[model samples]
Target chain A: MSKKWLSLISMVLAIGMVAVLAVGCGGPAKTDSTEIKIGGDFEITGGVANFGKSTVNGIQLAFKEVNAKGGILGKKIVLVLADNKSEPSEAANAITKLITQDKVVTVLGPVASSNVLAASQIAIDNKIPLLTATATASKVTVGDDGKVKDYIFRACFIDPFQGEVMANFAAKSLKVKTAAIYVDNASDYSKGLAQVFEEKFIKNGGQIVAREAFLAKDTDFKSALTKMKASNPDVIFIPAYYQEVGLIVKQARELGMNTPMIGTDGWDSPKVVEIAGAAALNNTFFSNHYSPEDKDPHVTSFVEAYKKEYGQVPDALAALGYDAALMLIDAIKRANSAEPAKIKDALAQTKNLQVSTGILTLDASHNPVKSAVVIELKDGKQTFKEKINP
Target chain B: MDSSSFLMQFAQQLINGVSLGSIYALIALGYTMVYGTIKLINFAHGDVYMVGAYIGFFATTVLGLGFLPALLLAMVGAGILGMFIERAAYRPLRNAPKIAVLITAIGVSLFLEYGSMLLVTPQPRTFPAVLSSTPIHIGGLIINSQQVLILGVSLFLMVVLTYVVNYTKLGKAMRAVSFDTDTARLMGIDVDKVISYTFAVGSALAAAAGVLVGVYYNSIDPLMGIMPGLKAFVAAVLGGIGVIPGAMLGGVLMGVIEALVSGFISSTFRDAAAFGILIIILLFKPAGLLGKNIREKV
Candidate 1:
């Protein structure tokens, strides 16, 4: 009888311990707040951690600056951060947790377009205002109606504009009459950019000698590069992320296909240099949000501050994240409330706001009509080339 | 496509397929050999390949070793890692159920993959150029010198392995142990030492394949080995598990078939074609290509 009583006590203790552990693991619950809360759902750990880390740094810097000037509407802005680990499913879960548990008035994040697509449905269902910083896919905001999304906004310019800019530059600036495109068929970003570039280049009276497709994770490009070389194109346009782009560049060089290469915003990564040696990367061009060489006082100040804090110049994603946060703060101050509906309304009216990238004006599709700068790699340094206006 | 261009492309694709097949054969031998001796599928074998690639990467890029020295170091490093894995993970469970060892192998694989990702950055790194950069042309076919080197090395290793398994004293001991561990032990063979040696050989071959593939492809990532490892496993099973020559045959056949499917049919069905062949083969030949049927004792 005493042994049975002891067993029962132990069982009760085990159950209590499990319950406490469960509660501890669960995220903090939403509480009545005099604090204006904003949640960031980002990939802090995963293949794309560097991109996520840069955006988080930008967001934190903006938050610190805003809070220092007396929090939005005299209420201290509380930032809640969650790591999504660069997985689409995790991004969805993080957004749901941010909305339901944190009760954040607004959300900023999810750098990848795939992750943004996964999380956007939750934002739409919950009627929460989500402003993405780095996702450039046009379909993220525009639906079948081609109109601005009511609750969704993106700080980056759409792919179609960037793609056309690249194609035009390749033809007129690089003077390439024949081009080849190596696209990652598995990625919507790669496919969309390739389609746009192909169409615009063909329209400009340039010939597309070969169009090759590869899996995103494909490491072998010899066969593809061989085929591309046989076609004898003047330039190769690879519309993929830096991971593949770097290797492709290196392999293409090794194969003696020394023609200049072009890419999109995905080329803005330090890994590119590590993979494609600085010497091999010469003459490559890419379109980005903003270059560090921009002489605008606002741009110079942000560059200086970023270098001071991080000991490195911020990439386009970082600038966009900083701009997105400032935009959110402006909306909140204009609305004079932390209510989601009011902030959504204020964001829709955002215009003529000068940002680190350029003057921000949301188009009908809720994408920022920002200027894109074309950067060229010369002697291992990114030089300011020309700016294209959307 | 024109006719000559089509023929040229087809020939080029065939060469590419064979080059890839050679790498697959190297890895498949490791899988088949381990399965032949011990019934456990060493899922961690792929990570062993990944470790080899990293070793080569560090040796070449960080330590700045020449090509031949870096490769030798990578093989030795991988052999040591393989022996360590056998001692730590598989040794304790020699008498356990096959499923237990299999699960443990998978656990070890995951541990290595995630551990590598956490320790090293998750991004893919470019492998240093270690092979010749020129391509050789023969009649309508063009092949890179690196591809030729890969094929030559793979064939040489396969031949060496076949000889070892057939003639050497260690080989005889391994065969005896695989046939019946209890009888082999009663005969005074050191089962533990033979098993460890099998892992070392298997892992060394996988390491060579890993570094070769990395250099040939010019990119290496943490999860790079998962798909190739799965395909190589299928190749091992298709060729008749336990048969060294059979694994090489199966690997080359699988590679050529995949390339043909991608070249003639659709690139999208490349993976499906490889696995579909395996399923069909399994349905007809349950014991595999060169597999022997063993009657169980009542």
Candidate 2:
């Protein structure tokens, strides 16, 4: 009976393979004249689903507008989305499927820095240009040997830039003499930002009174906060995602260690206010890619369109997603072809392209030399404070 | 650091540890009680705690119940779930190999975790503030109202548990069943009913711990039970697997050790410290701190 079942299963598999081959041979080529397919590898379902969902929304909106304007290069841009499920291994699988199976010309996203780093090598091997809107880790575009991955690029500024911006903001704007560094050990993004912030803060003539590390998903931070409180730094730099950040802030405030706290773009989610109460998040600041409150015509128009479409203000991830998609579209238009290698060259040479964020130009590292905005949280509202240009 | 500052930090972390340990102790009770009777570790105990938190979340948010009512409702809901799980999953495996029952428990655990994740998307929900977390300072030591509530509720439950076990007729029957199920049945005590009651009581305690943790942490997720559950199981083992008071003591000690390790050594090693202690204890005292070694009859 077992042998008979095995034979039946093998026969079914043989028939399925034949059907797939027949369809492959008979069907039109995967990419046709009507649409130009780009791949979207995003965290559609796991821990950072909100980031992925927002990014996809921004990408969809950008493509919608571009397609309505008689398409890019006279062919409508079609985004083939694959969910990474917020796992790095799954991210590699998503990108591989997008490139090998779907055969997209360009791939965008997998928003988290770690996810981008995991999937970047695949794009490099496949010679397909991969652009990420919100992955700010320096390693996303550069290798360990300090060489840029030609096929990899990001629309947002690198971690060191944002870290330096915050370090400068704390030392100069906030006039902080001593600061503590609370880093998430589990995240490449958090560690990169924390490392840079430490160096730049000390370079800016400030002392790091305390440095502590925590794994992500740790709910209780009181013990660490108490330990850090003994040093009593003027400000605490927590370069972690909003989930842990909200808990840290709430626990810190509850513990009566209410020093000013600063963070990076990971704190941009509205969930931060929900997890950490509105009152607890007061006096906290985070560096972000773009602020919707910006008076720039490009930002206002993009913000208005995003609000009209999604019925909410676009966060930094959404803005970067839109910018990344627009930048890719711009590169494609400049190259005047849908070829991946040409698009990579055009992307590497990106110069002074006006987008929702600001005047975006690719640096030597394939990172955008754009400005970072400092957003101050007051009673759960993100009030724009200052914009620092690199 | 100066002696005064070091001492102050030590005291603060101690309070924090006890508060955390109380939650562990509450979950540990469920493990201890269920294991005491049936000798089967309910791996799904932690997920039951997670379900309880969600029940408390909905009770507070949807039904607009206050803290006490929501907590009570969560306990009742989880208690029923515990009984249902025991009846459906464990009862069939009563005469089966112990390994089979253990495997079923783990299967039930996974089912609850992913099933809840599917029901409530993997997104972490912010549990509404059921109690004011106003900090009360006593010298350099600061304690929040929520911490006080956790300690109060945990202590109250432990006292009630002690009384019921020592004085009540049902508790005597439960004790009898744990000692020898065949003898208890021969003595006309319905063994099945006692087992069901044990599960109900254990699950209710876990639910209470869940609600309290939600109040303390302010964030609840479907997978929240995995870590705390394992830690509570360790606490039960460290205290003496089937010993009630031992579970409490082990839990508080575990919490304090975790707090001190994170405070003095490093936060990254806190989890390592917990399992490390468990290994050391198991190596030295195979029967646990309070467990007595009884040679099995030939």
Candidate of highest lDDT: 2
- Candidate 1 interface RMSD, angstroms, 1 decimal: 3.6
* Residue range B56-170, candidate 2, lDDT tens digits: 9999999999999999999999999999999999999999999999999999999999999999988899988778889998887789999999999999999999999989999
lDDT, candidates in the order shown? 0.84, 0.92
Model 2 chain B weakest lDDT span, ten residues long: B1-10
* True-vs-predicted CA distance for residue B228, candidate 2, Å: 1.3
Best by DockQ: 2
Q: What is the fnat of model 1 with respect to the true interface contacts?
A: 0.19
Q: Tens digit of lDDT per residue, candidate 1, span A294-315?
A: 7878889998988888899898
Q: What's candidate 1's DockQ score?
A: 0.21
* Quality class of the docking in candidate 1, CAPRI style: incorrect
- Model 2's DockQ? 0.47
Query: Which regions of candidate 2 fall more than 4 Å away from where they truly are?
Result: A1-130, A137-140, A143-147, A305-312, A325-343, B1-4
Residue B208's lDDT within candidate 1 is: 89
Interface RMSD value for candidate 2, one decimal? 1.9
